[model samples]
Target: MLGKKKPLIRGESAWHKGWKDLFPESYREVSFPDKLLGDLHRADIFTSCGTTLEFQNSPICLDELRSREAFYPKLVWVLNGKKFKGFKILKHLPDVDDPRLDPYDFCLGEHLSVYRRAELHSGAARPLNFYHPELRNIPFTSYYYSFCWKQPHRVWYEATCPIIVDLGGHFLYQLKQRPQLGESYPYLHMITKKAFVSQYL
Candidate 1:
């Protein structure tokens, strides 16, 4: 019963020379230590959201640090799981080496896709009767159960908690621990799906 949306795909752009012109005015005066800049220059790719930056090489960039300042100042708030505007805007660039050309992927779908999949896999199962220690801590059970029972209203409420609490918890932890590194979508997708299964179904 769920609808599927097409994925958004973007290609990499040409490399730019200086941080001074590329970043916002606020970041003009900021300086990257020489070692970090050297690493960035060697990287095969660079990708960033307003709040996070990922590089293929060992070096980090000054823009990434500044992006964190704008998007993740509090460090605890969950960023809305939305696509970055830069992904689409940068897609318009003609040059392949444009900084915005970093390859990126986005899947389009409603939040309930995960919840619905869990429900399908847990047909006719009673709530809390299943024994799975790994899933005991996940908070999406209520939503999954509601969907299984054909109760759409309950599904909405239950779905939101797990999506926020379970996903947000791990997301923040990862950002805090690995702020400079970028994650591939497939890896994150698998982790999120597995977490949803563990918590609810």
Candidate 2:
């Protein structure tokens, strides 16, 4: 557990106050891996706040904000093995002209602003399913799960599953069935890994 102390403010701008105000309780300046930060930027879901709450990062990309319905705030929580460390808060649509701030920076906001999906997908097709044998103890009508692909560049998807408890049942279950070929999953499909680098690299 992180020590119960205030985080050291680093950035030397007015925004530092905003960061302090956003997370007034407990904060710390822990160094994180740059590669991990890059991944979060690509996913558009990392936040300044450390791991603890669900609204640690934003899930939407800047390019997708043109759509009226795409303006909701999203969170992305990155897990390093079993421990959760880094996060980013994307609150709103960013000003396009600002050179100092990337579109990724403006994605922070309240957690409730984001949408929650119950099914994980690869593009338009569902790529996976989840089953938890311990769902009976959870209070929600559903639970959230994360999905990733074997190949890099493939986008991840998340979905929730309904929880049903029977008397004396001790298991909560979720399934991640792989999507069939030729189906549209949550992310775009392309040529194999070798083919991609051969053409681009």
Candidate 3:
């Protein structure tokens, strides 16, 4: 339901380059070629495994992150001010969670059409999740209950944690951890998601 996009602060070219450079040997601006409800929603990078990604150079709150999970697999946000006009903007805007407001902002329907399609096409018997575990800010039981409505069977509810990397004290990168239970979203343990303290540094 959190659908208010920040004022457009970044250019298309910067966003395209940023996301494309991060994930090499992957498809660029890969999107649903076929016409959906309206103009298609394109992922910045489509991994070989069909996991989609969108890079944003903007301030994305925890609730906003959860709202976006209903669409794509992950969103790599730029923490550096030098990246995008002092802020980030994404190429494709995802749909608002509320079905009524969906004007193809997210090509997938509220019924989770994209997730179903990916599951059907791929042979991997992984969990068919609409939202990524790193983005779901809700309680454990409530989260699974919603997933049930989206994917009842044949999907494993594997969760993942994130490793936030402080990029030279200016930028940050959130690397996702392996999927498992008891490992919740990273924001829970933080006073603020922007606080970057990495042991590796």
On lDDT, the candidate that comes out on top is 3
Every candidate's lDDT: 0.24, 0.24, 0.36
Question: Candidate 2 local accuracy as lDDT?
Answer: 0.24
Best-fitting candidate, scored by TM-score: 3
Q: Model 2, clash count?
A: 47
Give per-residue CA lDDT, model 1, range 59-154, as digits (tens). Answer: 224465344334332221222222212211111112212232232211122212111223334463223211235233334311111111121222
Which digits, one per residue and each the tens of the lDDT, describe model 3 over residues 1-201?
898743432565454464355455446667764244355667666666655555554444555455445455554333333332322211221222434222111122233222222333455424333355522332232111111113211111122223332233334534332222223211111112234322211
TM-score of each predicted structure versus truth:
0.17, 0.16, 0.32
Instruction: Please give the range of 10 consecutive residues that has the lowest summed lDDT in model 3.
Output: 140-149
Provide the clashing-pair count of each candidate structure.
10, 47, 5
Q: How well does model 1 score by local distance difference test?
A: 0.24
Which regions of candidate 2 deviate over 4 angstroms? 1-11, 21-26, 35-201
Candidate 2 C-alpha lDDT tens digits along 71-165: 22332222121111232212222222233222111111222111112221323322211122222222221222222333322122332221111
Question: How far does residue 111 in candidate 1 sit from its true spot (Å)?
Answer: 17
